[model samples]
Target: MSGADIANVCNEAALTAARHNEEYVKLHDFEQAIERVIAGLEKKTKLLSPDEKKVVAYHEAGHAICGWYLEYADPLLKVSIVPRGQGALGYAQYLPADIFLYTTQKLLDRMTMTLGGRVSEELHFNSVTSGASDDFEKVTGLAQRMVLQCGMSPKIGTISYTIDRGQDMTKPYSERTAKTIDSEIRRIVDECHERCKNLLIEKADQVELVAQELLTKEVITREDMIRLLGKRPFANRNDAFDKYLASKDEKGDD
Candidate 1:
């Protein structure tokens, strides 16, 4: 029979089995059925080099550790040293709960965390790698938002003198002001990078251990992370961001 014909036959048989043995149906039947279909279509993918694997491991571990050190970050779900589809050597996954507004301190905290992986590579490996390309993108994007959109920028004051729609993008600001904004962005990024580097340096030992675990097991869980780092630093205060969310959650005045 064709694959579709076979699947239909299997489904009919499973339905018959389910009617007869509901307990067995509840236990393993549905999962096994899906697994069989998935296994039939699976194909092997590319693997990673030893160095690339280590680089990815440390890079992802850096993100996990930094997030673990922050209060508002979601629980770390998984850390994998497995080579994925897009030549990624390792990756970490987290679910962001909510942050209504990005405050100056919170932005810096996030920037510091985002830069952690690259900084860890430098401190522990004595070199940098292309793995940090995505990280730099994230940090730069956050900095731009802070400077241009958020009014967090003291130089521009609280007033937003943004370019109007359909206006010349280049003509939005004078040549001198444009140069100042560029300089300001660089300065902010440098400061955050330095701060992140310092934080990683203090936790250098943890970085090495986490990377080593990733290399050995190919995955690390949240429990493993907590064992490595005691508690997150910002767990206590909401800053402006948390306050805004709380206000939204609360109903209208009493």
Candidate 2:
């Protein structure tokens, strides 16, 4: 975020503290402020039916569970079923590491994490919903970049294609190559979706636990995740992210 964004967040956080009649701004106030800045204000007045709420809870839980298990996926910070922004019915936030480069496995893991919500809906409800439109968009973009720009696809040799988004001109490749690119993108996304579906199936019990908790509380923190799913398996995870959470926990104890 830019300096202006930071200033806005701090200002909003102070306003949140004032609204709560607190003598000082707290870490949670800043957290809420950041959420407001990123997700827009919470839509408490926007109501959902019982069935819709249940689907949302499970969908978010699927994301959290997938990120929790994936070795290269970002560490989950929070998950919530409470409606936010204009179109978001639920969301899963992750503490992404400060890394410059990404490996093929890492990218694939992230794609699987992105597909978790949709796969979860399919597994549990035996149906899919338009709620996954954003996920599909993100996954498709990443897969295209991986194949066309990054040359990560084995089928397509290492060749980077520059796409000028400003122009409606034809792609700088043969029609046959375009077909191959489309096929490669579909292959990558389908593989990630399968991986996500398998992971959710294996951890079905934990998904249920997290979903039930979300149904009751509407929000679940990192602490809640650890309690429900146990520690993440990866040993070399982000230390700074862990320390931030620890600091928040200590402040809550005070």
Please provide, for model 2 over 87-146, each residue's C-alpha lDDT reduced to its tens digit, 9 standing for 90 to 100: 889988787877799999999999999999999999899677899999999999999999
- Residue 157, candidate 1: C-alpha displacement in angstroms: 1.6
- Cα RMSD to the true fold for all candidates: 9.9, 2.8
Clashes of each: 0, 0
For candidate 1, write residues 1-254 as lDDT tens digits: 36895686478548746767764444245433433343231113656778777877888777777777655455565677665545455667554545687668878878878887888788768678888888799989888777777777778656554655575666567788778778878888999888777767777787888888898998786657667665445656534434555797785553
Per-residue lDDT for 127 in model 1? 78
TM-score for each prediction? 0.71, 0.93
